[model samples]
Target: MITRFEELDWQSTPIGDLTLRRRTEPAVGQEIYEVKLGDEYLMSSLFTVAEEELADLGLAAVAGDGLSVLVGGLGLGYTAVAVLQDARVTSLTVIDRLGAVIGWHERNLLPVSAELVDDARTTLVEDDFFAVMRSAPVEGRGGYSAILLDVDHSPRHQLDPTHADLYDAAGLRALDRHLAAEGIFALWSDDPPDDDFMIELNAVFDDAVAHVVDFENAVTGGMSSNTVYVARSRGTGSASLDSTPAHADKDA
Candidate 1:
């Protein structure tokens, strides 16, 4: 596929270096601009079903209240912005390994994100998502109401191969400890994994299910899709294998 992104105004900020590219596809019939931090593709001005579905998944778990949430990635700050829109979300913490991505959101992407970077409910932590989640304190009472991760495409096709551990059994067991009672965990992947991942999730979480969302190429109107793994905490918040959708945390 020829990814033609025009070089717009570029800026090097705190989070990472950002380059703006506008894709004008005659076949798709519309011009789309996208932000890229370093080499990673963030999002475009046209489509965002993956990010939206993730937020929707988080909202489905618990009712509106003072809830705490942990977002694994901060690509263009779209998901973070969406999460802060809910009155129920009192504290929204985001962990991203790349400082430039967070900084790009703080500077350029915020306008595209509707100024969610300035929201007080948001906290930006520059660290590895897994490392931070495995160590950060819950600040007493009411642990994380949800853990939403948009780390990679899917367990089978990871954008960052090193993150494969998160899809493994051990990493998920560690993730289970951080969830509060009635908390939900949402993971975004590009493609569905094999049966091994499903088996592992079944062995770990109380509830887990695959939520597939369709996407169309803005240029060609071609169809594409992504999957979200939704898993809810089980048993007195200790993490036990419950029903498939309730506890499992792997893609379809």
Candidate 2:
């Protein structure tokens, strides 16, 4: 039998000390992967539903073919891998603040690493996602059909203070500028939807909806839920204007 636990890799990033771990989940009788910052968990392979949904729901909302995508966080590579599942997506640019995370994918430290890095369409960038969105348009980096953000714990509860601005009207506008004429933005939040965030989304994008993504939790035993906020500006709206969305500080 294999060892129950193993520490895969550890690296110091700008945000904090990052660690990648693999363990045999005895309860489920399966190997599991995880990413951590110091003692805090950033991502776990056991729970990937919302992260995958962030790509699925966001891409589904987009209206056109030949989609070019931009993903703000490269967690365990679930979101990026899910984005590639769509045949319409021609290109995918995934940016993470920590180069260490990107390195894991290239090194195949994570299960989805090979699929994510081997794909011809995927490009991984080591940079602050918030900073990239701010200068995305100005840098002449071209536009994207969809922008998926899963970096922060939530709009209200950012891992770092610098990420707070991206949830506001001004920051979202900057993000919108990087999108093609008809584009959408999807965000993953560990917390339930919020009304105040709906106010912010309505102010920027034409149509937005909050989805309560329900998933089972091995650690918690009971069912847990996440929020996926999808907003699109496609001339008119497909989602009703009355829906509300919100966020917090728990790392999903």
Candidate 3:
């Protein structure tokens, strides 16, 4: 038996106050973990199918070994852990804007923290994800094979209003420079697929797709879904808006 509710940790971040808590569900009789930012809930352990799927569907689209991955958010560490499941992934760098959130995992406060911190390939970078995205490649590594993002809620609904620009055409094009030619970019969204966002992606990348992942909602006792958008970068030096599909083999 567990306590009905407990607040494990709390911190004030640039965006808002973040709180990590554990609670017992009366109906299910199970303990659930939750992360809250201000008045909004960032994540809940009860529904992580979408988060896991964001990594699965994104990596599935990549076609090579020794793949290097960059995860934009470290929420609950589900996506980062999922990225490590593949033997092909030789390196993974997780970037988060809030150092406090990263500290939670580093302090072993979260369930998946131990595994993530112990993984030899995992690197936790305490920095602004978007700022890094716009900057030059780190240590002149050229670019990453896959960039998995779950920082914001969705393309349309962002926790921070400034993040909305990242979903735009110009912002995406700038982000593409950080990807290896044929590198894949995948994003997790709390909302359903937005056709307008797909159009913006298509305008920037060689190929793009939106995957709808379904899962059972424990609270509502019904089905719920989230969207994952995956897109392949147009190789460096290639025309930005070329209609021809960029072949990964040719680029490699």
Identify the leading candidate in terms of TM-score: 3
Ranking by TM-score: 3, 2, 1
Lowest-sum lDDT 10-residue window in model 2:
241-250
Local distance difference test scores for all models: 0.70, 0.85, 0.85
* Model 1 lDDT-worst window of ten: 243-252
What's each prediction's TM-score?
0.78, 0.90, 0.91
Give one digit per residue, the lDDT tens place, for model 1 in 66-170.
Answer: 889888888766678778878888898888876656776666644444466667888887777765444433446226888899867677766566677777776
Clashes of 1: 20
Which lDDT tens digits does candidate 2 get at residues 87-119? 999999998878888888899989899999999
Comparing 1 with 3 on lDDT, the higher-scoring candidate is: 3
Residue 120: error of model 3 in Å? 0.7
- Pairs that clash in candidate 3: none
Alpha-carbon shift of residue 19 in model 1 (angstroms): 4.4
How do the residues 1-252 of candidate 3 rate in per-residue lDDT, one tens digit apiece?
Answer: 545999999888778899999998865789888999999988998888999998999999999999999999998999999999999999999988888888989999888899999999999988777765544454566378999999888999888886777798877876787788899999999888999999999998877998999998878889999999999997752334233232232112
